[model samples]
Target: MLQIEKKKCFVELGKFLNQFSLEENSKNETVLHNDLFFDSFVDLIHLSQSHNGWFTPEQVYHSVQSWAKALQEENLNQWLSNYDFSKVQPKTVGLILAGNIPLVGFHDFLSVLISGHKVLVKTSSNDQHLIKFLAQYLIAVNSEIENFITFTDGKLENFDAVIATGSNNTARYFEFYFKDKPSIIRKNRNSVAVLTGEERREDLVQLGEDIFRYFGLGCRNVSKLFVPKDYDFQPFFQAIYEYKDVIFYEKYSNNYDYNKAVFLMSNFKLLDNEFLTLKEDTSYASPISSVFYEFYENIEDLRKQLENDAEQIQCVVSKNAIPKSIPFGKTQQPELWDYADNVDTLEFLLQI
Candidate 1:
């Protein structure tokens, strides 16, 4: 229905969103997204709970509004208005979302929506509710969006492009099926922090957020740390231990227990934080039960290793001096300029 010109629609959505204050203590009695077009998003938080983690409805509401604000930016609007949608006409995209973190697939979802393409979402069952809620909201904004979106239980086929997120094992399957087409197939890559031995205790405390958010399941969550061997691990450990209350969650406890038992059975050395178990490993993807860390004696060596391992890394975080291009906080709070998997989503959409 909305073949072109959505200026009024976005304006109305922004006005509707203003009705709910997204501050920490807003009562949850009102419609979250507010517009009749997006009322279906009201149950998203309930859906996140049904999955694995305990995401409050408030968190969902805030994240959605955050996305709305970005989309409503003047420069973003200018870009969308000038783009020739016909360049990517009728693109059929198959997307495999990662559930390691809350709303990780949102960027891809927006890439399709703003590019005017049809999306076939294969949501991670672990975080399926978030996407459904977001889709419902978009559809409410413009009822025509409903026809542009669809859920598929079958194998992806006849798609012009595909985007998949999975572990190394599943990536093989994705590559086998979608390699022939233009696609972005993400394999396991962990975010890491390179401490230059001069990091303040306070920064390490914030680094805890990088490690603990989403229970360390997201790709952006740092599963590995590269610290100087001479650097004392005590302050770093102490900073993270302050948040020992993270273990209060049953989900985190379950992982802690399961990983502890397995580590003992396999004879692995582990450092425990009551909530997180840290170990030394070369790998980046850590289990919900344990995080992996490695020590390096020389900053030069660490830099060299990271340079060699660049292709295998998603991000590098450090308060210490480093290249400006590397992002911090494990999470890719990327700008519109940050192309996913280093590929320009807009360009890819246009090509399709």
Candidate 2:
């Protein structure tokens, strides 16, 4: 299939996704293959949580809407405009997906096919259904796509290159295993926020979205905070109170109760807001239902520190407090070009 054909299929898939949302899921008869796919996709979205406890209907709908916005013709064109794929030869690219958040590996899947390569995907056990279902929709829209996509139940084979996402330990295993293949192997990384004393209440509230979205499971979620020395926590707490209902989710509440007890038993001082706990720590990866914070004495020194530790950080949320920092609540809505781990996935695929 031509590159334009691939783009058209994805655009149709996006339109199919655009019909469903948390508040409503009315079917639109105008979408292609609606009679076959529209109601089934809704059922899958509702059943997503049963497949994986974290993939609630709200989270799944959010993921779907984000993609619906991204896969428009203009967005795809703008993203692909800078890259040349005319000389590309088709090859099988193996994708090892991460299920930390809904559709976490869709970008890699999209990249391979859009670049005129066949994809052999090993879906993360935690996220087996959603992508496969979408692949069926894509094939329905354009039968040619069936030649380009495949999902593996066992070990990956007959692939020229690979893209894998996993923990720091699994990354090492991927490096040794795919040493000869052109690859992008991702590892554990966390996002952080830099807060001066000048943030507005609205900024901090949006910052709560960065913290609690996906229950803080995604690499892009802000798990740590860099606050100025003696910065008051009262306002931050007040602003984030809007997300207190997150605790009503049974799994999150269990984490909150358990982690809080563990901290209290260890005699560590905690700043608690009933639903979430704040602790003084120097780590980037914080536990769920909790955020780790560190006090910095100087902005310049902290900036240099983050620069040196860039490999360990996914994003920095701030109000121009740091260079190239993402806005407060926008971490989860990454653009197509916002390559994970700063690795250019398309460039890697084109080379292979």
Candidate 3:
């Protein structure tokens, strides 16, 4: 129902996002409403780090660039192609967003609006500014979208259905609170990488980006590694040395110092570089500045284990060693169709 005009509006917004990069904020004359929004967006990106220490300008720009590529006309068409939206009755769907990373809830926002549904958003306090600013730009591009978007501060009351993302404890609370409504409640999940000893150093180096991006705050960041028994970790430690500068960030350094001291106090053996620590653990969720690794006995056994534990994982980074796995360093670059928790968000929106 919103395929024609609204699609173009989003594409224009994409063009706007593309203009700003870490290297430079270049203005393209063709982009709509640049006079009103461009300078302000740049200011916001710089000011974001002050608002939330984890939201560095580089991370915010990376998120912006990713969304820009996803909002291309061809990408949008491809994403919406399979769904038949002929009968989508517009309803005000409420969203409870997470704030682990910058713009983490934008996908849910886009899904609801693009599927011809009104969205009532309750943004996490940690991430309150960027989404609202983006919404303003969308309204500027296409005035019709104004009625379709609303950001609420109080309890979400006037919505037909809900989608909420949070930690596992909060997920239980959401399930109880939204019991009377149709809802999708997401819980904590982590990503892991499967490594073979035969891999080149370049591969491990790329995996460092997967580990260090967004200070490993995003769910897509690889928090654990599955390695063959007796796998020499020298290559990994050597390769990830390129990311050693990550320790320069005060927040990351604080986490590293705190987590490393705690591990030392617990008498756990750690393979530590100056910046990152590798611990042998069975848990999927590792703290920031650290990655937990487990030695797998066999490929088949590892694959089966991953399948059994798929619900707790957001991504499996591998070189085709596992089915449905993404490549190293690519967990953060998900395509539009790659839904969080493997749930079809657009499908849910259309049905709602």
**Candidate 3 lDDT, 166-202, residue by residue in tens:** 9999999999999999899999999999998888888
Q: Per-residue CA lDDT of candidate 1, range 1-352, in tens?
A: 3444344444444444444334532323343345343344444455566675546454455455655565555736665664676645677898998876667787787677667788888888777776675567656667777887887767776678998989899999989988789888888777888777787788888788777766666666678888777667778888888778777778778878988899879999988766778788888778875778888877777788888987777778886455753535435445555555566777777887
lDDT: worst 10-residue window of model 1: 24-33
Runs in model 3 deviating more than 4 A are none
Q: Considering only N, C-alpha and C atoms within 3 Å, which residue pairs clash in candidate 3? A: none
lDDT of each: 0.69, 0.95, 0.94
Error of 3 at 142 (Å): 1.0
Candidate 1: regions farther than 4 A off: 1-42, 54-69, 75-86, 325-332
Give me candidate 3's TM-score against the actual structure. Answer: 0.99
The worst-scoring run of ten residues by lDDT in candidate 3 lies at 1-10
**Per-residue error at 193 for model 3, in Å?**
0.3
lDDT head-to-head 1 vs 3, winner: 3
User: lDDT tens string, model 2, 1-352?
Assistant: 9999999999999899999999999788889999998889999999999999999898999999999999988999999999999999999999999998999999999999999999999999999999999999999999989999999989999999999999999999999999999889999999999999899999999999999989999999999999998999999999999999999999899999999999999999999999999999999999999999999999999999999999999999999999999999999999999999888888988788
The true-versus-predicted C-alpha distance at residue 232 of model 3, in Å, is 0.5
Alpha-carbon RMSD of each model? 3.6, 0.7, 0.8
Rank all candidate structures by their lDDT, best first, as comma-separated numbers: 2, 3, 1
Off-target runs (Cα >4 Å) in candidate 2 are: none
